[model samples]
Target: MSNSNAERETWSTRIGFILAAVGSAVGLGNIWRFPFQVGQEGGAAFIVMYLAFVVLIGFPAMMVEFVVGRSTGLNAVGGIREFAGGAWKYLGGLFVFIGFVILSYYSVVGGWVLRYVFGSATGGYIGTAGPDEAPVAQQYFFDIASGLDALLFHALFMALVVLIVALGIKRGIELGVKIMVPAIIAIFAILAVYASTLSGAGEAYAYYLSPDLGYLIDNWKSIVPAAAGQGFFTLSLGMGVMITYASYLSEDENLGIDGGTIVAFNTGISILTGLIVFPILFSAGVSPGDPGAGAIFVSVAEALGDLQFGRAIGVLFFATVAIAALSSAVSLIEVVVSYAIDEFNVPRVRATAIIGTLIFALGIPVTIDPVMVDLYDIFAAKILLVLGGILLVTAVSWIYSDKALAELSKGIGSFSGIGTVWLWTVRVPVLVVLIISLYLGIDSFIDFLAGPFAEFLA
Candidate 1:
């Protein structure tokens, strides 16, 4: 309270801040992709990789982000300027710009989730998830995602985001996440418990959790990148989202503890999502299911359709997804709003309105053209985000260097012996991993465009 300013706000409580962080991390990925990956890779082995990734890459990078934001007390752009100075000032703008490009397409995808929510409530996809109707499920997604429907829903989703963020940090983002995060956790916990009671739940559990050291060794090549990427990404690092959020924190707040807490909650929700998913899937007799891009839409939707109370279950799952999507979307848009507030001296409302509208306008193309959506998603996930990760690593390594560590070391053990280890890890190994991942991702995306987009455009 000592450093209070009329122009800025801090989280009302540490708990509220943690909740918002968890909400940001727990997104559509947890519900669908994380669960399927757990099931596919053998739970124990995947969890091993997940924990390793968190410890090695996610934890250190997260603390550096917090240190930068809290020390400088600004959004990504200004924070970098404060910490490093010189040409580095403009470097923060890269993250801000990355956030903008990401949110534009991200909102469109969120709109698609909203459409699914309505469909779930109305049982529109009720029988469409049946084996013979797999094509119907695919068609259902396309039908809602294209043309006018897509545009309207995207607008609706962004409107909700604009409304919340316009309320500013304390009243809007913090309050909203406090409610949404706990509710998401509670609902998924309920689903997990319910799933555990299903007749074939044991089989799902064994498949999801049983240790498979041999499997881990056998598949380490493919598995390492997957776990590392998800671990880093699940924290929403490198987007300026964390930087913006942490900028609202009091310096006395424990960056190390907060980062750990966020990871713990994020991992818990991911596990909860898996427990809920695999059990219900086994009970519903949907097999050959591994968590991937369309896994949740296809398998989860199918399982819900097969259930006795499918209408209610359908509503619950999709509603959970909607909340998760909204939570992340709030962070994405807030990055831009924070940048505008800092850079241009704009009123929060005016900044949000203009930026929100502009981002929504950018999404119109994705709404109209699914091909473009796929392209943007690929570009964002594969290229922009990887580049963002590398940039942060470089910034903390050479740009911020000693200052970043000194900031992190303020009464925190994270800045000491082990912290030095963290520094080198991010500089060499982590940077190497990210760069290689970027190369592989771009290669895969090009192949995808060559194969699928080529046929579709033709």
Candidate 2:
């Protein structure tokens, strides 16, 4: 709080900001959720819908976050209050809360990735390495996914996220993403090429890329919501990440171009992930199976084990996952840490430590029981994320339309026409799509909540 707005840290370069934003967008949501969701839904049809939603819903929503952040040059709560004062701060607080709720369990999954890295390196999980590896990998995942090992790795992962964030925006976040994002792209690109040479690549590509329009038409009701959720999830929308990252921008930076680039890179990386995962699984005669950690840790891990040099590939693959998870976790934690430092006068180091500890503690239930992870993931992804996206678009489009346009106009230049078009996109298509996603998500919300409530009442 001692530092003026002028003294607050900003990205050292435009590319640095973009990489950090892309890093936030590309995480387990892309690598973990995208492939399984594609498989569990109708494969190519789901993917087609996801891409459409990303263009229609995700991109505009991201622009809204960027507009809010860059205009105010403040954290989510302060940024909203700058435009619409009074109780509107609660909306911003909801964003900060989403960051906490997400990173809590998110880091648990990050922990699992870290353990997989170790397990792959030492042949710990490769004993039954083959096409039949999934059942063994499932048992292996079940064993370490909870209890003391899970707790230890979860703490370890949280520590890494806190360390990077505590280093501050330029040295911590920007620097970390600069290194992590390229490595993610490079590794996945290489993996995609390798996966392409597999015999099943033909079938996998057909399944992943060749849209079944008839299937999509038949399943439009289900596929649309899932696609919208994935679009929001993969792009890091509805989570205050874009808002926090954009806050560090200079006035003249082009939000539209940067937002577009981030979305492009995120969607490309997610598609690359599907390329790597599906081909490998099909080559091994293993289905991607149902969504969740099983799709990656069980199915993909098993497929990797069946290949030549599978262990080495597993290490490299899971290490990339670890990097992606850490990069995204940094943004999530920064959302809260930046809030504390900006609004509460807390030092960066102290805020990170205290907040990181609290998040890790919140993840303890996730370590104690896998059910906690499912409940948290479903609620956050299905309901909270979509709801957040809808509210943000509503705020910028209706509540602060003039202010939002003025901020966007700062560096818009030749893209000035986009400002008006984007406004309507936010008002209609983005809002309507997200509302539908939220409504469809209610069934899942109820299903996930019912299990825990049933257990509690029993």
Candidate 3:
């Protein structure tokens, strides 16, 4: 039961590790959150700020997690403790908490996605009648998005996550991501090509790619925070996912190159998703600015239902989401699972089982109520995620600066010069933005607590 580096499982290959890390990074945030944010925040302008934040903030912050994980070769909690010791372990504890809470509601959404996949194949919602006068797809989404069917699907999805993580690093996670990430990219690429041929493709492309500088300049304050949050979440920076995933890596792997590649792939996939989504919405004469769950479940579903061969395409789209969700869920559950296995000397299967069941039980409220999903996200995912990132960056940049640089220097040849730049980036801009984002997130979260969240607590 000793969780030594010698006994611990490492990723089988560099590419396998990259794919798994990319899988962890690319999730509903890319497919579900990104396009909606783009639409809601003025399309190309938001994308512009998003990409800027990715380079300026996300990449360096990611490297901080990479160095922390690979240096300790331990789970999130153990990793921070190994390097910084004492109270710093709370930083890693925050990671475990975020992973646990986020996955609860995340799986609920995953379940809805699975239902959509099945519904698409069965034409369950394609031509169905609405109870009232609402659109069939919209009504169908409302029905399945919460309640009994949602609970069942959520359990089903969480079971898949637990099964994969319980199988250990190589056999389960590496193997799963190798297949899933490539398949996700392939499907999105094909869909983007098909989407380009849609009727309103021209307008969609214009809206998605052509930024109004005036809009960005005029709305930089709001757009900047939204884009920063999106960039941070999409890269999976604040969640300790990168830390957990990087722990499975070998020393010879170039961390800098791998980080860049993962970011590149994740960013590209996110943009490609927007390309596929906007055109479909535009073609169907559906506005893309509906935001959040409505953008994907109702708007996209309605659009797909109206297209030729729409049912088949819907199957592919939701299936991709299901896969993406599962892939990300694997990493999230693993953060907690790995923590248990590494710190408590618990067996992987037992840890996955106990932890997965607890997470599923936690998700029940969100499944039944649905409103808890947003509440859980703002309070658990966004706030804690930013806090974790801030703590990790501070610990790396100040408390363990030299050691962090040494670890980052390993396997990075010409990139060795990056240590100082990375340090300052982590110290200055990354920390500044994360702190600002955390403040804004807390402000909003407190507002929620005072409003609807208070009602939920009651």
Once all C-alphas are superposed, what RMSD does model 3 give against the true structure?
A: 1.9
Tens digit of per-residue lDDT, candidate 2, span 124-201: 665563775456667778878999999999999999999999999989998999999999999999989998999999
Candidate 2 wrong stretches, greater than 4 Å: 1-3, 129-134, 451-458
Whose TM-score is higher: candidate 1's or candidate 2's? 2
Worst 10 residues of 3 by lDDT: 288-297
Superposition TM-score, candidate 2 onto the true structure: 0.96
RMSD values for the candidates in order, in angstroms, are 3.4, 2.2, 1.9
Native RMSD of candidate 1 (Å): 3.4
Q: Lowest-scoring 10 consecutive residues by lDDT in candidate 1? A: 1-10
Question: Tens-digit lDDT track for model 3 on 316-409?
Answer: 9999988998998898999898888888899999999999999999999987665677788767645777788888899899888999999999
Candidate 3: residue 456 Cα off by (Å): 7.9
Query: Which should have the higher lDDT, number 1 or number 3?
Result: 3
Give lDDT for model 3: 0.87
Assess every candidate by TM-score.
0.90, 0.96, 0.95
Residue pairs with backbone atoms closer than 3 Å in model 3 (clashes): none
> Model 3: runs farther than 4 Å from truth?
128-132, 447-458
